[model samples]
Each structure stands twice: as structure tokens, then as C-alpha cells.
Target: MDTLNSGSGKLVGLSFEMGPIRPPSEGGSYSLLIRVTRNCPWNQCTFCYGRPYDHEKFQMRSVDEVKADIDTAGLLCDEIKNVSWELGYNGDINTQVGTALIRRMPQLGNSHSFINVFNWLHSGARTAFLQDADTPIIPTPRLVEIIRYLREKFPSLERVTSYARAKTIFKKKEEDLKDLSCAGLTRLHIGLETGDDELLWKVKKGVTAEEHIVAGRKVMEAGMELSEYIMPGLGGRAMSRQHAENTARVLNAINPDFIRSRPFTPLPGTPLFDVYMNNELELLSPHECLEEMKILIAGLDVTSRICFDHFRNPSYLNAPGQLVHLLKQDYDGYKLPEEKGSLLEFIEKGLRIGEEKFLKTESYQL
Candidate 1:
């Protein structure tokens, strides 16, 4: 009776809808996403475009709503398995056919939405991400229940993660965080954009540098892997050096499990973009940004792994000549303290290339 086809009255329709965003790491994980909250409660970060948070009012879903999402995701797994069997798939659906099957879903209509489910199953759904930015800000008890219920329904799921605002994570008691971790909240992606208080205020990040350090350390202490996203040129031309140095200082304090390098890409819609347009915020050219990134990498004294995986970051070594195009990663990712010198060398080389690429990029932003 746990099956979708078993008259559960839970999602009579086979189709499923997930929130608009997930961490870049989760994109390839085929992770089941349960949107516990509506939009961001604090969507004021100027560098952020947490869509549809940009246009929608924020709201929290009830416990029942969250549970229903888990149930639906569970049923989806069941239906996908059923469809695979019907198609004579002996526990393995080829990627090519799985892709083609997805393409033909509309022709099959809602009645045959199992094709959609089959696509997921073929890809090996092994993880889950609680979506719609910053779920850790949700009440501790409610979040605990949601995590527990999600694990119960998808017990074999490998890991569960969610974005946590430093302000929210800092406010939660240490004991509550440990409880949440025990309840299966394994990872957290925090946007510690910069360690400069002035930049934090300018971006409206809602947390100071000290709180960011505290919240990040708290996550690690509670047995959660922390991925701190650091923007290289968030301070723009004015505070670029301070941004890099202060960010390095903060990362050294937390020594987070992962330091994600997110080079600044001014969105045309945000206040920062307006600041750039009005010449109030002197934007960092590709060379300056790379130099800033070099300073950041050279200054980092953490044992954390660094990932220059975002497309916005220039991949000096790997991509060869995409320095200004906003199109390549230097490498997959690197474990810091070891690859530190090499990462800096790569960035330094790119800085020497001295090309203004971002200005030439024709709208990579959607």
C-alpha cells in the first residue's frame, strides 16, 4: 500500500514538481527534492537572484504539506520501478532510452507520466535536497520532523542537504543542530559571500562576518559538512582586497568542508547591477577579479577543499583560453592546504593574461 498505484490518495497524478533551485553539486545527483518552504524569507541579498523568491512572497509549508511531498517522491520511485519492469528493464534502464523516453512524455500525456519517473530511476536517484533557499531557518522541531519523515520514506537515500543562512544557523541552539544532524540532515550550503561587514550590509546578507564564522563552525561541530560559497569580487573595485583578506580570515576560522569559489557576475536586475550601471560600484574586470581570487587562494589557511566549479569562475589551466568568456572551470575541485600553491599559480597566470572578458560576454545570465 506504500505504492503510488495502491489507492493511497496521495498524489493520484504521477507527475512531480520540485522547487526552482538546488546547489550546483546536487544537479547531477538525481536527488529527490522536497520543498519545505515557499520562497526565501530574507531574499534581500543584492548579488542573489533566488527566483521565484525574487517575485514571490515567502511562506512556510505545513508539516502535512512536507510529508505529502515525501510521500509523492516515494510513490514516484515505486512507479518508476513499475514502469521499468513493464518495459522489460532488468533493473537497468539505458541512459539514451531514458532521455528519449523523457522527450516522448508529452505525447504519452499525464496518464503515462511514468516516463518522467523512469528518467529519474535510470539516472540513479541516490540523494535528496531540501529546496527553496534556506530551509535551516525553519523551526528546529518542524525541520527535524521533516528530515526524519523524508528519511523514513526514502530510507535508502544516500545523503540529505539544504541551504542554511548563517543568521538562522547561528540562532539555532547547538543541541538542536545535533538533533537535526541525527535526524539525517547531513550537509549544509551556506552563502558566506564575504567576511567584510560593509559588503555584507551592502548585499543585505542578514549576517555579519562573526555570525558567519559562528554558524559555519556550529554546522561542522554538529557533524554536518559545510560548503561556504565565497565570492571573489563581491566588494567590487572599492573593497576588493578587504573582501578577499577578510573572507580568507573567516574561512580560516571555520575551515569548512568545502569552499566554493563563486566569482562575481553582476546580475542586471539586482541593486548591485544598478550600482555597476550607475558607476557607483566599480565592477572588477576579469583581470582584477582573477587577481582578487589569487589573493583569496593565497591567503586561505584552511584545510577545506576549494571548488572553482561554477561556470562564472575562469578555468585558467583546464579551459586554456576562456578566461574572459565566463565559460570554463580551471579544474574539477581541489583540496586546500595541498593544492593551494597550484590554485594561486593558476589564478596568477590568468591575471597576467589581462583580458577584459566579462564585458564581451553576451548575456550568459538567464
Candidate 2:
């Protein structure tokens, strides 16, 4: 890494690789990002079609390369702290420190890695997210070593998380999953999409409903918190009912820690988009989407927290013309069984508000 002197302190080049996307919850937490892989291992899901990665082929970084990135992150963290101290903030990272550093090095204003580290430190440096589509696909020992090295470098991290595929989790041996948990991987986010078998096949998710259940159960059993992402309106009009009820059935089976809602919107480059344009898949209206949410929530018997953390979750206009989200969009959403009635009531309120007042799924693309 090249070093530059700025008066009394020095700033390293601070460049490191980062992936395209991560969960919204991770973003909310300002988790330090570390990319272990390049893209989705199986990028054929009709709903997404790997557009997040610009349809790039997947590749796993070597352990050495990942460790180098971690080292660079640590070095950057130290440099930020040094700047804080030099600026008389007593080693604290705050807006003023960030502003001063950016003023000193204007190029860092455009550096994603620098901004990621700065925000992470400002947020207490407690959580980290491994990036790119699937992380567990890396060999077990290698993944474990990477996690251990990360923990070694940043002792303050309270949790480490990554995106994983149900099929990959299903294929992992029980011992491997346990080994990963032992290595400090605290959580996983798996895209369940929908539990209806037909819809799963149509989307080419590359995993069966049974595989999803097996994978979810394995992650929980391995002592890691499991977050299963369910896509509302993924079934379109034809399979909405099956999508809702069957998804509830699967969640009931695994009882994951978090059941997240990600309402589907056809992106321009996806096969699903083409199908929507060709008039083959009819998207549910706002009211119909809430009806589907009602079925799914009503059928769920899990103790998991159902969250609508995504921006695309259903929202409506209140009486005063102010926009209101139907459900709380927090990372720790309402607890189920205990708050099931409240959730259902919220759904009913959305329904009573009528379709015209609610934002339609067609109004946005993500």
C-alpha cells in the first residue's frame, strides 16, 4: 500500500475490493463489508437473473487475497483513528474527522472502501458482512480460516454475517456447518423467494422447498441465527395463494430467527421482466399483494420475527396524504405467535385502506 503524508499524519492508499450488494439490514447496521466471492454461484433465478452483479460469472477469492483485504481494512481503520487523534478528537471517529480527512485527500471522497470503513467505525464497529451473492460455497476450512483471521484482526466485531443459498447449505455436511459456526459466522441470509414447488421451478432458484427447510434447520442447529428472505408477489397472480401458504408452511417447519419480506419488482434485464412485458406473468395489485401477505402471515406458526425491512414492502397514503408503511421496517420486526394477531390486524388495515391508496408493485423497479 502506498502512503501519503498530510501534515502531521499519514493516510494509506486504503483501496480494497467490495461486492455489489448486501442485505438492507446490514446496510442499516453499517456493517464492515468484506467480499469473499465475486458473484452468485447460481445466477439463473428468473426473478433476479444475476443483475446485481451485472450477470458476471462467480469466482471465490483465495484465502491470502481475502486476508490482504482484511489487513487493508484494519490499516484504514487505524489511519482513521490517527486522523481523529491528530484533529484533537481523542481517537474518536465522527463527522468532523471524516470531513477533515476528505478535505485532506479529495480522492477519498469517491473511495467506497474508505467510506465503508469510516461509517463502520462511526457505528461502533460491531458487525461485519461478507459480500457477494454466496459465501458458504467456499471450501469449509478456507472459509473458517478467513473468519478466524477476520476476528483476529478486528476483535471488536460482535457478529459476522453473509448471504448463502439453501442448496449450498443443504449440500454442506453437518460438521462443516458446525465448524463455520465455531469460526464466528454468527448469521446467514438465505433467499427463500417462495415455497411453492411450481414457482420455485419456474424461477430456477436451483433449490427445492425441502432443501430450503433442511438448510434452514441446519443453520439454526449449527448455532447461527438464520434469516430467511421471502419474496411477496413472486408468484405473480397465478400462484399467489400457493406461494403464501406454502411459504408459511416452510417457515413453520424451520422456525428461523428472522422471516424477511422482499416484495418483488421485475427489473429490466431479468427473464421475469420479459415475462411481465410479454403479459405472461400478472403482478398482484397493492391490495392483492396485501392479501397474499395476509395468507402468508396467517399461516405462519413459527416463533421467528417477521420483518419488512426492504423499501419495496407495501406502503399506503394516510388520510392526510402522508405515506405510511404497512408494517414496521425494522431489522428486528414483530415476534411471531406473540404478535401474530397484531401482524394480521396490520394486514387488515392495509386491505381496508384499499388498492388506490397503496403503492402498486409496478410503480417501482429494484
Candidate 3:
């Protein structure tokens, strides 16, 4: 009564999903995502799917198990290459090229990219992502060994990255992070969400505002490129102002190399989802979110680059060029592209005059 499909060899290796919530990082994408571990190590987050059904017992596959998955992936890549040539497509004739191709094709939506496939097929994967939430929580030497193995297995692997928790980074000795970085752990992505203390607690982030700043500095100091994810509207309807101001303060302290804006969306199964459905955690409308962002950008003191990388966010202020517009004026005299006059005139018409009439004008959406 074995229900698993073991005979076909079709679903043998580590598979992956690139879906609505999670996507690959900027500047780089993965062709193959070998899931060395399953489910998140920390499932207490108020917003997440846990990836796997139950997350209490975090698991790490043995070296042999991961190698077997890699072997299967290699075979899968060979099959794909044969299929490609049969279809008259001439690519790199190597695995990395195969991986890059797999990513471009839309039909392979949920599967790991060809790089992952070919890496598995040829020398074994060059780069690997330690799955679940906090892979850095794994012992440093063990992570180092995994990285060293990956480098030896695939000589082209210039980088290996992982999802690191702020708490984990804070607890680790600085030497350990540097050691891991030396072992080819090139980058770390930490979800900073918001810098506001109240909002952090409300979202159940389990880290203090100071902890975020301290942990971020540590990562950069350890010689690893750090990308911090920030959620724009996590504070809900009531705390929007506080959220914006506090977030700015936190970012000012961290001065992260990359500040990525991810507009808050409550997934159905998460606690935030329930909060939205029951009207407990009222979301700020799009306009209000923009205002919050304006406050955030205006408050930014550090010259670190910011990126509005996620597609889900609709506000223009987050994009690369759009931030310049926000910098052009104070909040009072802000003008949109369609507006005809200087922002001062609009402010005068609305604020100075008894003109409740500007609301009828096309400038404001709220």
C-alpha cells in the first residue's frame, strides 16, 4: 500500500515553489532550489504558511539524502537536456545554462530552475538555499561544511546564501558570522518588516527594534551583503503615523545596504488574515500607505540605496525614480504627475482658502 509514486522516477529530487508570497532575490535567481530542510524552524510568526503542514519538528536531511536528491536532479537535468536537443534548442550544453532556461519558461512555474537541475545532474549543486525560516540557526561549522561541499561539488558557485533571523545573528558570536561568510555564505536576507516597537510586537516578530539595528550592523560587519525586507503598512489603520515615523527611525539606525518595500498583504490562513476578515486589523488604504511611505522616506537620514522591488506594491514612491518626486517638496505641497501647477498653489487652494473644493479636483484619491 505504498502511496508514494516511486516507480516513475519523475518526482525524485528536491522540488521547489516560486509563488505569490515568496520570490527569488534581486540581482540573482536560483535555477535549482534544493530543500535541505523542510518547513520553517520558527512557525510562531503571525504571518506565514509554514511551507509544510506541521512545523513543530524542524528537520534537516542527511548529507546522503541531499546527495541522493542531487543525483536525482542530475538525472532529471539530463532528461531535460535530451528533450531540449530533441526539440532543436541549442543552449550552453551545460547545467547552468539549462537552469537559466528553466526559469524563463512559464510552464515550469513551481519547479526549481535548470541550474538546480543541472547542478544536481552534473557535479551537484553549486549554490543552495537552506530551507525553512532560519538556516543560520544551524550550527556554524555544519553550515560551513555544507557550503564547502557545495563549492567543491560545483566550482562555479560564487555565492551561497541563507535566510537568517535577527535573533540568531544577535546571539551568535561575531567570529561565527565571519567564519560562515568566509565559508562562502555570501548573503543574508532578514525580514525587518517594521522598525516600530509596537508594530513589531503586534506582528509577533519577537525581536526588539534595537535588535533589528544591532543584528543588521553585525551582518554587514561580518562581510556579508545584507538585504532587509520592510513591510510598509503592518501597523494597520490606527497606527499609520507612528508606523511611518518609527520605521524611519529604525532604518536610520540600521543603514542597511538594501531596503526592500513589501506592501502588507494578509494571506488567508495567517493570523493577520483573520484580523483583516474580522475587521480587527484594519488596513490603511493605498493613499494612506503612500502617506506613511512619504513620512518614512523624508525621515531617512542614511544614504543607503532603497528598492521598491516587489510587484505587489502599487505606490510609485517606492520605485527608484519615484522617490525623487517625494524629495521635491514637503508633504503639504505634494503634487502628482497629472497636476498642472506647483505644489504650493495646490496647498494654498486647499489649506489657505476656504476651499473644500480641492477634494473635487483630481489631485487626491482619498
Best prediction by lDDT: 2
The residue-by-residue lDDT of candidate 2 on 1-366, one tens digit each, is 113243413443667899989999999999999999999989999989899999999999999999999999998888888778767788888998888787768888888988999999999999999988999999999999999999999999999999999999999999999999999999999999998888999999999999999999999999999999999999999999999999999999999999999999998999999999999999999988989999999899889999999889988888999989889999999998999999899989888886898888888885
TM per candidate comes to 0.87, 0.96, 0.70
lDDT of 1 by residue, 1-366 (tens): 111232222223555456677777776565666789878888788877554466577778888888886776667666455544545565465654344344444443353334434444556666788877878777889999999998887667678999888999999999999999999999999999999888898888889999999999999999999999988777888999999889989999999998887777678677777777787877677778777877888888989888877776664333354334233343237887998777777766666653743332124354
Ranking by TM-score: 2, 1, 3
Which residue pairs show collisions in model 3?
31-113, 32-116, 74-120, 74-121, 99-114, 99-115
lDDT of 3 by residue, 14-128 (tens): 3533211223452234424544555566666676545333435666656666665556555565555554464345423454444444444434445544334544434433455
Error of 1 at 146 (Å): 1.4
Global CA lDDT computed for model 2? 0.91
Evaluated at residue 196, the lDDT of candidate 2 is 86
> Can you tell me which runs of candidate 3 are displaced by over 4 Å?
1-22, 26-28, 49-57, 71-128, 315-366
